[model samples]
Target: MDSKNKQQNDQKKSTKSNGNSKSQSNQTKSTSSTKKQKQARFGEEHEGKLLEFFVEEVKDIYFAEHEALKALKKMEKAATSKALKDSIVQHHGETEEQIKRLEQVFELLGEKPSKKKCEGILGIIKDGESVIEDTDDNTMVRDAAIIIASQKIEHYEITSYGSLAELARTLGKDDLAELLEVTLEEEKQTDVTLTILAEESINEDASNE
Candidate 1:
């Protein structure tokens, strides 16, 4: 009888152990599933936020480029040196092209090309206009001022395009990134040209004036 009782107890313990093991395994699976769900939710939210910000920045730069076109025209008119005028004219044409490129980016995203009011670009443009107003016309000083103002604008474009390109890449939009990088290179080249103009002659001529 005692041997039979011992056998029954052993069987009960083995069954209980198996039940506990299964329970633990199920709990672990549930925990893992919950973690995965949370990660997925967070990823989706992050992607949504990033895309929204990217679109907004695109709109901001769009507005800025338009404003820049107008500002470049004014600066070109205010400039005295033929070199400076030619550079401005080239950049003005490039700006138009950049705008078209931005429109293409919008189309890629299946969105209309729209402008968002960018106060920063407007402020910079205002400062450029002020430079024109402060400097005298038909003088090297005016040309120098124009160069400085144009460089400022180029710097802004460089920053905007560089950032937009990186963001586009992050969003897995390689085509958009490629477009933005092209503009970014153009902006950098324009900056280099402006710097060369200043260092080679414009600054010296302005100083003498």
Candidate 2:
């Protein structure tokens, strides 16, 4: 009788252990499935208010870039330093290319490339114009002023592009993100170039004046 009771208890323990193992395995599978679903949530259809907002922001930047083109032309003409003028001209060309990229981004979204005036950029441009007005032309001080104004614009672009790129990724629009990131990098490089020009000679020359 003792031997039989011991065998029964051992069998019960084995069955309980097996049951726990199965339960744990099932739970793990459930957790994994949930994780996969979450990962694939933004796969294709990005129809939401977020997307609408993103599109509007893109349009804003488009208008801002157009305004920047005009501003760059003005700045280039106002600038006395050859280096500053050349940099502005180069960025002006890059701004054109950036607009083309934004057009492509609109195409990907099945939308036409449209402009929505960005008051923020408008204000910044106005400030830049003020800088030019306040400083004397054909002087290093004007060049320094131009550099400051240009950097402000670059910083704005950086913020816009960085935010847009992240939003694109969240929408699972990797291609759009790539395009925005490229422009973001360009803006950052432009800012750095301006800084280098300032530190190398523009600022010092202006101070002497």
Candidate 3:
């Protein structure tokens, strides 16, 4: 009888061990499935919130820079000072490069280069036009107009690029984040250059007039 009881206890222990093994296997499978699902959702983290806002914003940036290329030509032609004219031409070249960079970013995201109307940029350009028309100081007027227009543009880019960097980081796109950080720093540097030109050259000339 004691041996019979001992045999029953041994069988019970074996059954319990098998059950635990099955449970552990199921748990491991569940963990692996979860990891696979996360991998499948890789870029989904960038789908919502200001990312949609950023997409539209970047599209506007592309259009604005393209438009600025034409506007820069006009600004360059209208500029009286050789230094200011050279600056406008240089910026035109930079603008072209910036547009190309934006296209690269679009390609990275599997998108085509496209334009979106940017009312903010339109308004800024219109304001610059008004300033150019109203001021009779030809030597300083175009320079001032360029500062107004370019600074506004730089501010917009700074905002957009910063936002894009944040979005790229959130989406685990380290490469994109790095690219945007570089762009953002460039925009800031350009703005500083414009400020220096305005304060040291344009504004001083205007004051003398």
Estimate, for each residue in 1-209, the C-alpha lDDT of model 3 and write its tens digit. 25698578656655655566777757756765686578557536535555666667668878888877777787777776777777777777777888888888787877788889988878877777677767665667657776787787678778878887888887667876887787788788888888888888887886676
Per residue, candidate 2 scores C-alpha lDDT tens digits across 1-209 of 25598578656655655566778757755765685576457433444778999999999999999999999999999999999999999999999999999999999999999999889999999999998999998999999999999999999899999999999998889999999999999999999999999999999999999
Order the numbered candidates by lDDT, best leading.
2, 1, 3
- Please list the C-alpha lDDT of all candidates, in the order they appear: 0.90, 0.91, 0.75
* Regions more than 4 Å wrong, model 1: 1-20
Global Cα RMSD, each model: 11.5, 10.6, 11.3
RMSD of 1: 11.5
Candidate numbers sorted by TM-score from highest down: 1, 2, 3
Pairs in clash, predicted candidate 3 = none
Best by lDDT: 2
